[model samples]
Target: MAITIELDDAMASQLRSEAAARQMSLEEFGRRLLAEAMHRIQVSSNWRARNQRRVELIRKSTSAELTAAEQAELDDLQAELYERMETADQDLLDRIADLENTVMP
Candidate 1:
């Protein structure tokens, strides 16, 4: 059976606008969302299991010292994550700006 998910008025308007921009029907757009949600669910499941293993490993590393190269790699990963977060923030700001001018409220 197909499921119905309710969105608040604002989110529904945003989805409709995005679908219009892509020249897609609301049903087609919703299918895309469902597909992405499935993928995300799988990823989160894997992440949680891996995170548990990581926590176990961290608990086992009481006297572990980070080598210079390891520290550099950690710094690089942090920088990349920060940059990705910044880009996401910028995209959110742009979307909010678009929403601000919508007459559908």
Candidate 2:
């Protein structure tokens, strides 16, 4: 598919410089960057969906005694959820720092 995007001169120059530094054509660099971003977005969405289901199960278990297997599954999911949340918090802080550098005086 062919699409036309209008980037301001500053952004276009920055992108061109980055592509040149990487020894990649602008199209290839843009494609790789976009593909990586999309993959991250999809992974984040899947993680949220899985975590939501786990949260629901945990909540339900609060109302009744979970079987041994269910309890084990919940324990594993909770650990993973905590780890992911920590990573996400760090990512957010990093992004905030980047934005501050870019836009702050």
Candidate 3:
């Protein structure tokens, strides 16, 4: 899947300058960037797969046929977990946004 693309002189110069500043050859710098990008994509995919499995397990467990008493108890627990997760999500989002605002221009 290797594709050849031409970079105008300005962009090529910029990349060369960046590589030089980092004490890396341009080829090595590009290779490192590509590796990092691939690693990020892989990590993201793994996280998504794990999360999907977790959701599926939760759904299967929750929807099983069970005695009424057991079901009621499970329902109560699930409701509590849902509420806590919702609150945590909001708190996490607020913290992330606050941190971004503080660190980013």
Each candidate's lDDT (Cα)? Answer: 0.76, 0.90, 0.77
lDDT (10s digit) by residue, model 3, range 1-105: 665658899989998999999999988888887799999799667756655655655676777866676556656656756775798899999999999999995
How does model 3 score by TM-score? 0.48
The true-versus-predicted C-alpha distance at residue 4 of model 3, in Å, is 4.6
- Models, CA RMSD each: 5.9, 3.6, 8.2
Cα distance off (Å), candidate 1, residue 59: 1.2
Consecutive 10-residue window with the lowest summed lDDT within model 2: 49-58
Which should have the higher lDDT, number 1 or number 3?
Answer: 3
Model 2, 1-105: lDDT tens digits are 977788999999998999999999999998998899999999889988878878878898989888898788888888988998899899999999999999994
Q: Give the residue spans of candidate 1 off by over 4 A.
A: 6-9, 63-105
Query: What is candidate 1's lDDT per residue for 1-105, written digit by digit as tens?
Result: 788889999999999999999999998998998899999899668756655654554454466866676556556545655775798899999899889879556
The collision pairs in model 3 are none
- The positional error of residue 96 in candidate 1, measured at the CA in angstroms, is 12
Q: Which candidate is the best by lDDT?
A: 2
lDDT, residue 99, candidate 3: 97
Which run of 10 residues does model 1 get worst, by summed lDDT? Answer: 52-61
